[model samples]
Target chain A: MGLGKTDKQILAVILAAALALLAFQYFSGHRSQELVLEISRPGAERLRMPVSSLPQGEQGRWHVEGAAGGVYLSYWPDQGVHVDRATCPDQACVKMGFINKAGQSIVCVPNEIIIRLIALEDPAGQGEEELDGVLK
Target chain B: MTAIKGFRGVTKTYMKKAAFVFLCVALSGGLISCGGAERAKVPSFSSTRFLMDTVVTIRLQVIPGNQAGRLGAVAGGGQPAAVPAQEELEQLVLAAFNRMEEIAAKTNRHDPGQGSDLQRLAAQAGDGSWLEVSRDTLFIQEEVERLEQEAAAVLPAAAGLVDTSLGKLIDLWMGVRETKVLPRQEEIEAALALSGMEYIERDWAGGKMRLTLAGMGLDYGAVAKGYAVEEAGRILAQAGPAVYGIIDAGGNIKTIGQKPDGSPWQIGLTDPLKTKELLASIELAPGQVAATSGDYQRYEDIEGRRYHHILSPGEGWPVWYSHSVTAISSGGLKADYYSTLLFLLPAQDALELAESIPDLEAIWVTASGELFATSGIEDYIKWQDKSGYKLRD
Candidate 1:
């Protein structure tokens, strides 16, 4: 039963592959290999898109309709997400500039919209299914 | 004999099982301990907005220990639902800023298109007419009157320290900052004469504040912004005790609660003379505020000597007793009023005055490069420049 050399080789290869995947995840800073964009209107979720799937991160405006009104948002990979335009009287949201960091968001109260960048690598905010209530 | 050999072989397999279980236990135990550190990791959320004629930066955090095992519930119905705790904290801060906007709209004095209630009060004061304003304006006026009476009762020698009666003096000095032209001495003297509260009347029952002196103006510079900060704190306090953060409104700051790890909030004091330098710092527990008044910011050079904004009613000239004074109190408005009042007093008198008031402490930077503080201030203040003398008593 202990004589098979092929079994030993197979086990070693599997262990090496698992360790390599973990190392890549740690160094690259994203377990999922891509970033997810979570969009919500004030309190509720509106849409979620992968950063690469939406559009090329050119300096351009994107609009997403909400319950209150249309929320004008823009994304630049270099700068992050900001409110380009909105229906609100005070342009405070527009003035907030871009929020690119994980768990950071641009909240437009007038339009009741929140745009947050979720990094799978950021365990404090890891889960995409729900706004994490449990921190650990 | 064969059975005995089989048992030995089985014992060797059991030993392997025991070793593997011990290694698994060690690795998972390490993971749990590391994850415990992350639980203490309460992320800080900061937002900056230009409001009230200055940049207002608000930093807020949620105490993880307050979650009480309930983490994902939305704040309430009138607001959005299904919000995370971190976003909920940010939303609460934004709501506070919105309240500040209402305050700014009511108090703005420079807007000519649609005058704020404060501007209207001034216009009515000029024409000898009954001035009606909002409750917020009335509240500010009441606080000014109370402080005015307090100063007169305690420090008669420093009478007219701030000159609540000289609304005209405030306006004249404001012109100096904006236009960089010093007002003629005779004009300032005339305003200083009428700047006595003996000339004005307040009808608390009727919600009216009237000025009897003709050609006089009204300014709420000493206490307006701090009062707004206190009001904003009240808005957040209604949310819950879990709102732990700092609201730095220019130099005046109000801290809501302890930090994430339950440590007191530590604030760095900005150097009055040196730009981008910290002269000292102090720790503040929850529900405390610190307000620093420095004569360095608004000043004009006349010949060689510099003239600052805080002017004396008795001499109708800039007060040069101290470079800066920071006051600590429960409410921001109180701290702000005391800082301005202390800045006008001589350094020695300022320390004595701070000691007399209950729950009030002050740290003063004297004109002669000395740092002095009330007996209570020494316990909390972390002095950066020990070169300056400290009046520990």
Candidate 2:
């Protein structure tokens, strides 16, 4: 038997509701992921916090005790993260300047510490492919 | 009229049944799509640490049900096994880092207090005594010798390009990096004289090494990090075939397996001139390594002349034939060794040498901002920035 006007309307309403649910799932899944800063030191627990949680400007300065000595770190919304002071001889971490992008890191070999920037979610499924690593 | 009414009633019941089934199907499809998104959230673990005087990062994704057979074979001891848990992967990463740290300590030439084997051997230089060293040290020295012989066979001028015995020359350059002063001719000559493979005596059977000259020394700065990275990759590969990961030790990049999607890992080659930008991107398959030697990494400007840390044993000064040389080979040690060797040679000779070698490809950014790459790597390289550099045919 052919479907009547009322039957057709009922089917359309069901289909529309399903599509709306699917759309909601898709859009919510595609929301922009947060950027996180990961601070890791040898023989110590790693600390991970969202970049937005960090205080901006001079008030954002802080220090962490590393294997060698104390390493000072500062964060600015515009500049990202920077190693203001480090007791390591090379000062390589300090010289690394501000690292803001995902996968960028500052390493202090003498202090056995590493500070890296990472995204909370994988960006691989996005249109642009994220690099696994950079060879300098 | 009664018959028509009966048919309508049946039709209406059938329509309601059809509608319920369609609704169930649509809702289930939505649920399945959500399930897929949840499944895509694979367990990923990464660890970054300071080792070998550089930052080493190991990132791994534990994919389940991909290579279950291989994982069971390696980790399950003949039992039907599932994929490794998150904690096990973390342990594997830690193990890799521990191996790297051991290699770093053993090959360190700077401080004797670290109990470095290289330093101990250097202290006993010219004593005419065979000093037993760790197997790692012996392996590195022997590899250097083999690389030297292979390079010499291909191009006589390329011989001694990667001299691990250039400890004195490197020391002088380190001082120059700090003081930013060009060393006198006499001082350079003295360092060059003390630097040569002939001064390095080896007892392969006994796993012993020594330097014949009193002031001579052995340094593994070129090979140590690569060796460590190679070993780390080996450890990861042993864990399971399903474990896909990348170990990047300050540009000495080694991949354990392909990405979760079975695609190759992409590595960005940094621009030497720009320093902050990428010159190109290269795809690296499993078991392949990419290493780069650039004047931008460690250098000093003296009177407008830039002297990098990569010193030439023959010239006793930094080579300027290329701004940066990136070498890709099957093994990390080979890649590391070749990048430095090619950087020390003229651009043409470097390209020729790289072409002659099997399974080795090189890209050279010349001192004049011209780019050249081996034929095999042309397809793999995706140029990112061409504003300042011109690619030569």
Candidate 3:
């Protein structure tokens, strides 16, 4: 009734598989917030807006006039909001469009405008419409 | 003598097992920790079309472990093996483009019900039916002409007679019906057909709202790259145990499996203005896709104005908002397309659209280097300091 070759081999295979699965789960569990962008300017005003207050499903927006431009910032669930519009001939901020998701961005080079996408805390119990802009 | 031989053999066997067990237990901890270090494998392939003229390079990694047990070795349909996964990916993209062309034809083609003959005569004067009309695009055009004629006849007289509201509504309806810009895509059409919803109606499935007619045309160009990555991931996963792979189709990427030391896959985000530099670095785990689109990636300077390649379907021009946008999600295709679409839409509008899809997550970067992200985006993002981009959310 001693352990046989076949039994030992089976045990080895099973052990290997279990170890692999455990590793997979461990890796899956450890998550890091992807830093989509960083905004650093000398004297630019920063505005904080909720993801809900912004466009429901969109990420970011820019309003640029002749010499000024403002950018609205938000996240998927939070719809992080900001204003970076100023009057400038470049009006480059308006042309850049929205940057809602991580690793995406909208920059107004002329007005020194910068808006980025980043991770945020979820506001629970938010309506779908309010959260739509952040989500999209 | 026989008993002694048996005893010696047993002792040797037990010693071997003990050593193996010891080795297994010792390695278990490392193996467990190493599981998360999934590095993207760059499959060797050639470039096809460039994203904004920047050459799109593709790399595919095949999974070597359990994935093989699940998705490899079995051919679903009759396809050739000489075709690299990258080529397959390329084909998928081309197919989508072709589909778009088809939808465009359907939208602009003349419809006979629109009084084609008379409409053409009015527009062409005495040219008769000899106008340079594409046979494939005739029906829809005809329909548009008929609608236009009818609208013209009614609008002149009703310009001031009826309530402005009724007249405006009619004009809007006629305009849409006459000049159809939104083309029907296979995925959207398929989703609608499955849900039995009208173009204007919306329903929720897979935690995302299915809009019948999103008004925005569908192009898999953004999402298809991710889809190709996903397909490559499927192939790698089926390879065998200890198999690790990464699929990077253009900028869209998917990685599933740990590296030798068990670290997450690191991806560099490109700076819009400086193509040679990395704006930021992102780490991704297995079963995830990442995509980035930047205005600097493809742009044509016209009269000193820089125009990027990411164009809005209805606007017929590049979007004006953020310089770049990137989205990471479980599905490669979803992440790829969402990033591109996100760049064109308003911030709030993009978020709403993303929110409609349950599995989709996103992060946005503005022109001034400000950052924002969806709530779920935190689950997958890994940021690096010294990178000018900052997260908003």
Per-residue accuracy of model 1 over A24-106 as CA lDDT, tens digit each: 54454433223545655432212334353332232234445444465566666556777777777777778888877767787
Candidate numbers, best DockQ first, in rank order: 2, 1, 3
Query: Which digits, one per residue and each the tens of the lDDT, describe model 2 over residues B65-98?
Result: 6555555566567765456676777788889888
Model 3 chain B worst lDDT run, 10 consecutive residues: B158-167
A best-first ranking of the candidates according to their TM-score comes to 2, 1, 3
Q: Which numbered prediction scores highest in TM-score against the true structure?
A: 2
Task: Give the proportion of true interface contacts each model preserves, from 0 to 1.
Answer: 0.00, 0.28, 0.00
Most accurate candidate by DockQ: 2
Over B1-393, each residue of candidate 1 has an lDDT whose tens digit, in order, gives 995455345544563454444444443422333234433544335554555555454656555654512322323423322323765666777788887878778777776766887667666664677776677777876787687667667677655575556677777877886787788999888778656766566676787777776666566677777888888888766545455666667657788754445455555555556523446556676778787777765677777777887878788888888888888888877888888889999888777778887778888888777876888867766555334445444
Q: What is the DockQ score, from 0 to 1, of model 2?
A: 0.18
Q: Model 2's lDDT to the true fold?
A: 0.76
Better of 2 and 3 by DockQ: 2
Ten contiguous residues minimizing lDDT sum, candidate 1 chain B: B68-77
Off by over 4 Å in 2: A1-128, B1-43, B66-82
> Per-residue lDDT tens digits of candidate 3, residues A44-106?
212222233232223123222111333333333333333434455665654665565655566
Tell me the TM-score of model 1: 0.64
